[model samples]
Target chain A: MQTPSATLVSRFAMEVASACFVMAIGALVCFGAREFGIGWGDAGPQPGYFPFYVGLIIVIASCGVLVQALLQRRDRRESFLTREQGGRILAFFGPMLGFVVLSVLLGMYVALTIYLCSVMVVQGGYRFHKAAAISVATAVISYVVFEVWFLVPLLKGPLEAWLGVH
Target chain B: MENFGNLMDGFGIALSFYHLALMAAGVLLGILVGVLPGLGAPNGVSLLLPLTFTMDPVSAIILLTSMYWGALFGGSTTSILFNIPGEPSSVATTFDGYPMAQQGKATQALTLAFMSAGTGALFGVVLITALSTWVAQFALKFSSPEYFAVYLLTFASFIGMGSASPFKAVVSMMLGFACAAVGMDGVSGNVRLTFGFTALISGISFLVAVIGLFGIGELLQTMEEGLRFEGLHARINIRDVFHAIYTLPKYWVTLLRSALIGCWMGITPGGPTAASFMSYGLAKRFARNKENFGKGDPNGVIAPETADHSAGTCAILPMLALGVPGSATAAVMMGGLMIWGLTPGPMLFIERPDFVWSLIASMYLGNVMAVVLVLATVPFFAAILRIPFSIIGPMIVVVCFIGAYTIAGSTLDLWLVLPFGILGYVFKKLDYPIAPMVLAMVLGDKAEDAFRQSMIFSKGSLGIFWTNSMLVASIMTIAMLLLFWPLIGKLIGRLRRAI
Candidate 1:
């Protein structure tokens, strides 16, 4: 049977592994950039050279640490994240991920309205009417401030043309 | 006499209605942000920068500078009234301040904190007023090697003071340096990190990164913890204020020491956090009621409050004199300076005396305003804690997204915000110090530019760094100290054992 300490160690090992995976992807991007004929001094050095090297280093270092953490002996300790704590992380990360997806499809204003309302309702536990009212008002005000008054062309997706914002 | 003339000119600009109004607005907004936990001066200033696009350079500088001072003052308010510190720099105040509040000396603690902050700010402003010219002249001597040496010192200190393992700090710092290397290479004007995205050409804005790292990252943290506000019910009476003032003379030595430490730390680029910690530690060791230090000593609150404010104020010195920002807030201010097309350096004093001096003078006025405003409104500000965090939490997230998008009018920026927020959360969980990462990110490109420039000048030989005695000495000293840190730690341990 696995001990509690062993479980914690295993969890930490998994996290290190995930971090390494991300770093590996970053390294691939760097390598691909290098292969695309971006040299250190081409046109004063391509945009990818420094960041490429940096990403490569991160991958190497992250892998080393991942291996070290996996091989380390387990020590008994309390879990840093309990199930409840994990739930809280998901509560935040889930809606945020949804917002990013929505933004691309629904446009910034509509997506913002939905995002704000959901957060206020789900995370804040606000009354439906109050959260909905606040969300809509905030989005409108921001649109006026940034788009109309400042003359910044906010990213208007196909939906905005459908809605005749122009 | 020359100093007097410069100050008079500074006053003329500062007293103008346009500058004065901007300064007042900055102070008010700064206080609001600084009083809120997790929103400190840097975030506050960065958030407000876009608003300054419409402002004249002079008005913008005054506003941002006043905000910086106000944030420093406001940070101490929460530490005195509640156990929570509004910012990292105010952490030391919570040690003794909250205990004093618990003992029903809330008014006295608030008054002392405000007054000390004001005094420290005044000292810092005066130092800048007096020494800026000399400092600028001296900083002009700095070549690329010298700059790289300073950058090295900054990273080294993070490792020295960080709670995280040295390896983690180094890795975090390298990550920041790498991030800084994104966009076009400064020396060669070649794009290095864009990875074929045209949007990446202009490069990632430091403001965008800062907004994501501090603003969005903080929202993520709050979401995880389920934001909760603890309210305080206390009436601040005038009698307590007077009582604190009467007792002020008793802690004169502590006050002076703290002010000096604050000024030194500010000038050296360590900033308010270092000054506050050093001041608090020294105060605890030397205070008359040393045993009662942690429990609640008035000196404990006074020392940190004084030092933090002073350091915050003095950080402007390097910005004005050398165009080198000592802190993140100052970096944002530098951005403002560049937007206005006014280069911050020795010429700022020579050519734009009105702008430079007026900003310095306003610090004097702004500090007084902050003290009076905070003291009079302590009860009102403390009542903010009574507001439900459920409402505040969602509001903060909305603001973070808007702030990010507003920087460039791009959803890509807003999208980047979440990943950085997660990164921040991971760093926090791992107990890695974020300060080094931030400092390195802000200074990394400049440091790299300096290194490469020096190499080019020396025909690709690294020996140029040693050719300059100042650069050689500073670099060698820091390298030696960092390499020998374990030995120093061991020696300190031995001394403790012996004692």
Candidate 2:
């Protein structure tokens, strides 16, 4: 019934969800802390003792937030995000995910070239030649800065080995 | 007088041509980073941190601190020209600054901001010079209990003074402590919370978290908002600059009050952002022409810029004296200190006086250079803003990922950036304070160590916190009061109403 730009999720839902997620993480922290013995020993408190209390506090605080959110649910109907905003975030985040994956596969320089060019062409409405030129230039500059000057080796793939560059 | 003599020696150490060049380069890069969206002082310093690994500690700190000053100055530029705050601390500057620019007083507004900012920073550095030795001497007598109390007070003050919900702040802070606890325990020689994952055994790097949160997270936010920089064209005229300088004396009251507020907040961990807002609020409240605020009032621009820069400059003092960072940026810099094998506490003054003094000396020189360099470079940075976000956005993303990879050369760390980025975005939207979390991540283990040591000293009795030396007791009392101040204020209001 609403357009794509309409509210996708209300603030109350997001608040309750985030608080629950935090509560779950707190539970996990507490569970993990118990493995190391959350107790005071001869040398004083055990390794997990401090974390145990920290996790307990997190849980309690999260519960407080959750309760607050629930109590104000009737009046707090502001949207956390519109559908259009979610799409924009996804569009931005998707390429980032691809860049990371491609970096692991094709090395950062190659991945950088591909990712930059594609994002520019697909999302930015740039001509292919212009995007390629810019992306390639960026890759070369980063290569010089990171590899040649700084001497910090990056994660390289088979292509770099074939090209006989470190 | 001894401190003064040492400061002179510090000037000698910091006056080298090489250090001065580094200062210039650092400031230029800082301005670029600050002017750009999705990059800020914390992430910018972290990105440069790996480069400093090879440099000496004093020079490295000088470079980073100069960059900090430049970033503080740069943040205000965007606020005036574009109404977009390049830094969180400069958000208050946009209130009056943009309106003044729209009224065609761009040059005057900018000069006022830069002049007041420079004056504020000078006051902060002077305060540091005068108080450093005394604070260091006082802190030298502190034991584990006292140290624990200080850390407790730092965390409690965030809850007490932050505009965020108290419970949300607690959750964010506790999450940081939990993350900090995920590594091998130094005291017990026992691995913790790693869940049998080899990657987490070394624990979560705050650097990675910072990259994700401040860098990538910010980019995501910018994307969602579809931010466009439609800014006024500003070119500083020499006449306007001098005229503004001539009129600067008229605002001496505003300047002095703001500087004091800035110093108080910076020393007590309220940070530059809060200090600016607080200063702006107080200025507006006391001003006879309160209606002129948020319009084209020069005092509105002067107050926040003065408070922001002064708070930023004074925040470094606590990091030097007490190992507690007064802001998130200082927290990142302190993390860098640890990386450089330097322990940041009172003993740093005794053990590494040269390093400390040189750093102090550079703060003075850096602010002077920042003011001069920022004025000349405003047009250049404004032009940079003309670059479409499409190109710059992805470029920043690449830079951020590369920075993360360089931190430890681990693929896992790069992978970790994604989740933390989401966490940063969600938390920010929900008003969960990130600075407290970052501070906790930086100091969590140390605070825990101090607490444990105090417990061992007292056989696990909490009374030692209250019954120990007057210093420890007073600190604990103050922390407890701050933590419960909201509740007490409410109770007092009810009592007064009943009467």
Candidate 3:
């Protein structure tokens, strides 16, 4: 059993790690942009220039945050995440992540249909027929409204491309 | 007279069927978003921004601004009836609002909140109408140095005064500013930190970060705790509505004071939460029946409600006059303005008087509509509370994703929303103030741009900050105040001990 203070210290550690992760990502992006001949310009600046500095700032500030998190007393810390709280986080996001991954493979319409149906049936406890009907109806309607009427292009996935529907 | 004529011209544009429909839809959606816990005005507006891509700029702005006003009003509804605050600003309302509901005066409390919100919104609209020109003229004198000073002052005041820990607040603010700097060097055109991902080209969307931090974050926390129902129900009646208005005159001073506080706070970056808290504190300090404050006192309801709405309404002024958003909601509206290709700033008034005036006019109209619509539909909204969290929770998640996807029409944005949501949850759990982070994110770019511009103009001499008398004084004052905050707090603590 983890004590509350220990849990808090761990949480702070997690925060520091997350910040570092973000900073690292930012640094990598800046370095890549630099390689693309996107340095600061003579006539003011280029597009990637400001971003490089921003990434540096993130790295520096995140380091400071990490240091502070490390130096902070355990008793003064607080746990923002716990195992018990993970259910709510996962329940909704789990389906969302699945939806994204599925969209890439199955295409927008089919992916949405499957995702919605699954959400309604599994999480919503709706009957199979009811979930399927609702999902299909919603997808069809959205396709008509956004794709046909609004002329907003919805991404067709790799599966659709194989079908010559690009 | 010219102002009145301009306002009339504004009404000409605003009264059109298209604009009216936009306002109504915006307000309705705003209310829905505000009533939903973990979803606030900024997120709502940001989510809906992509929809306005097809709309004319004027209609788009009117719609977004109306949504903002509507959300502020709607937030109070949840606070009063369910003891759940939809937004941080509505937290103060929960103090007396819940008590009133418990006392079987839920209808009365709801009505009073709505009416006071409307009244305060009207006051805010009037101030914007009257003072926008003057404010814009004054803002024109603000160069990059002054703008930078103003940004710094706003950041300091928001953190130092608002947060529980000034040091942590400052750190949080700097972190946000750092995040804002991640994509590009605005001045030198040098690439700063993009490690190499093509996504880094566009930089992080402030909207995405805010949505993730507050929206997804809260969703994560809600998942952890599991949804708990307190089992509250209330019936609103026509007589209760009348009673709410009759009860208003008794707290006239509180209303005026709160409205004033709301207006000033909204114009600056103090925002609705600060306004609500400040108004409640002032009301408590000066109320004749201070003992009754926390115990379902009507004055208690009036104070925060009025200020919250007024602040919400007046926040538009800064966005319109100076292109500065005082709150997250205002930031969304600014984005809307930008989408419309109508830049918000002093030039807005000169170039787009019709857009400016009409938005102001619609505030007056929207307030009346909100009051009538909310009063009539209290029972309906209350009925929504009966729906189980399980159902509402998943639906909210779907909407969150949809909203995120709508903004940039990118999968990366959708993915980004979740982390921010988790971040929001962490912030809430840790009792860190999320408002500072959101505000910092919004102002971060502007601050950077102003700093760099000022540097270029002054040939790298920091002394240019003091070259302009007004800028010099403001920066000095802000610096002195920030430096002395700890000392002031200690002195106050000692005084309290002595007392």
Candidate 4:
């Protein structure tokens, strides 16, 4: 079996998928517009008037793109992403997801430190102490810039509350 | 004459120590970010826009516009020294810049590029002084019909001028309008399209969308390629700067020609990138030393640099006077204007004279600052390129996430960043342009409002758009332009062949 990283999605598949997504959104918007009343009112045109045309245009354009994608021969289709590139994307995506969750739970400063250190260690293969130093430095500097100086409120968690930083 | 007096007053504010300091800091930040791979002026401006919330609108615009100047200037250094353009606009600079660097005149090439850029920028500011006021005055007569027509012209230009398929561009634009529609319908007082979600009641924040689509989206895209920067070493001495300045007056013809081309391109919405390439090609064809054009010709570096900077600066004129931003970066600035509660259009010229004129004056001062700052700190900015993308990539994401969160100070914004980021990545990979999306999101509400008002005024007579002589003439011009699209395509194709 081909490796996940090496797996390729055909261009036709991507095009059709995107086109279908657009068409679905278009249909939903159009349905909403009709319900909202797409006509002239006593004071002015109804609120839905502009949206109805916008939705129609989207559906028609998406259909055209859909047809274009479907009619193309298999040999003519281009490759969207190679398996290796896909793997590399997921490598970044996984940590980003983790970082988002961590920030939600642990606070931005704490999460940033961990995120940077982990990236340095896992991705760049740096020593733990060195990674920690840089991460700490970055987190502290960002804290000064965004929190202290700017005085902008930030989303924080237990760690910040414990440190009395927030 | 009154314009001059106002410009003088504008200079009064622009020259203030606080404004000057902000301008310098912005240019410095701009150069650093522009030097980084996968970051440029629009991303820099959008990322920093949240910080400007506490500052007055004048200082805010000065800072952002200065960043634009610095980014354009910094873009050339990489192009000249390393043949790595920070953005597409600088790609033309690489044609002769790298060759000159290879010939060991890298300092001279950088200096000439900076000087030519400053000259072109000054020229664009002069155009603003001479032209924008008249346009603003002219726009004062406009009613909703005319306003709708102008909006249509801006949208139609994207369809006509873009390299993307017209259908796809429209789809992208429609998607933007759909996102815009989610917010409360201002007229009806009904919160349409919210789908009953409490968070959806306020709608998708354009600032959040920008941060997500550009900042986080870009970070992911950069990571997908791993490490890609192979930066060149650069050094510039005082002697090289003086020598380059001394030799500048000798290429006056090329300079003037390039400046005019830049001005035309910027105002016509040809965009800086296109202007740069078109100028470079024209220079090569027109130069007296045609045979030596590619072989480290200094004029080769001057033409594109001048055109690119001029186009970038002059793009603001249309953005300021018409509310229709001509470039993606300008669109971000327009979004900033909206966020700051300033409706950008001709009315701004009347209502916010100090803000508008001071921004114009700051463009002049900022270009000077950009040149001085870039010349002194080339090696410093270049060193940033040496850092691994693996390290830089995650840091940018952190900044983007923070920026997104701080917009409304909620975890919701953090979550909001991802889907938009993913969409941006997909759009970039699919070669569907993202500029139209951002522009549409920003202008969709205003355009729709204008259309509704126009219909009311016309009493549902579709002919109202053509009722007045000026409106009729304007609409006819746009129609003629659209009608001749096929002919224009063929002509452009033939020209490409001949070239």
Which candidate has the highest DockQ of all?
2
Residue-wise lDDT of candidate 3 within B22-90, one digit each (tens)?
Answer: 888888888888888767887878777777789777787788877877788788888888888887899
Question: What digit string (tens of lDDT, one per residue) describes model 4 on residues B1-499?
Answer: 9899999999999999999999999999888777765677777888888888888999999999999898898889888877778766898999899899898898999999999999999999999988888999888888788887877777777677767666777788888888888768877876667666778777777777777777667777767765576655788878988999999999998899999999987876667887898899899998877888778899999999999989999889989998878777898899889889998888998899999999988988998999999999998887877777778888888888888887777788899888888888787777677777887887888888888887888788877778755765576479457535645888999999999
Better of 1 and 3 by DockQ: 1
Clashing pairs in 2: none
Model 1, chain B: what is the TM-score?
0.93
lDDT of 1 by residue, B1-499 (tens): 7877988888887888877777777888788777876577877787777767777777888888888877887788887776767777998999988888888888888888888888888888888888998887776777777777666676676666555566566667667776677676666566666768887776677676677677666666665555555545668888888988888878888889999999988876677888899999998888766899978888898899889988888888987887666666776787678767887777787788788877888888888877887777677777876666655555566666666666777777877877777777666665555666666666767777776666556665666776777656767587658745755887999999999
Retained true contacts (fraction), each candidate = 0.31, 0.82, 0.23, 0.74
What digit string (tens of lDDT, one per residue) describes model 4 on residues A58-151?
A: 9998997787666764556567777777777898888888889999998888899999999999998899999999999998898888888988
**What is the lDDT for B184 in model 2?**
89
Number of clashing pairs per prediction, in order? 8, 0, 40, 4
Show where candidate 2 strays beyond 4 Å.
A1-4
What is the C-alpha local distance difference test score of candidate 1? 0.74
Please write out the lDDT profile of model 2 over residues B1-499, one tens digit for every residue.
Answer: 9999999999999999999998998898888888897898988998888878878999999999999998899999999999999898999999999999999999999999999999999999999999998999999999999999999999999998999888999999999999888888989889999999988989999989888988998889989998899999979898999999999999999999999999999999999999999999999999998899999899999999999999999999999999999999999999999999999999999999999999999998999999999999999999999988889999999999999989888898889999988998899999999999989999999999999999999999999998889999999999998888767878999999999
Q: Looking at model 2 chain B, report the run of 10 residues with the lowest lDDT sum.
A: B481-490
Estimate how well candidate 4 is docked, as a DockQ score: 0.67
CA RMSD of each candidate after superposition = 4.1, 1.5, 3.9, 3.3
Candidate 1 global TM-score: 0.88
Ranking by lDDT: 2, 4, 3, 1
Best by lDDT: 2
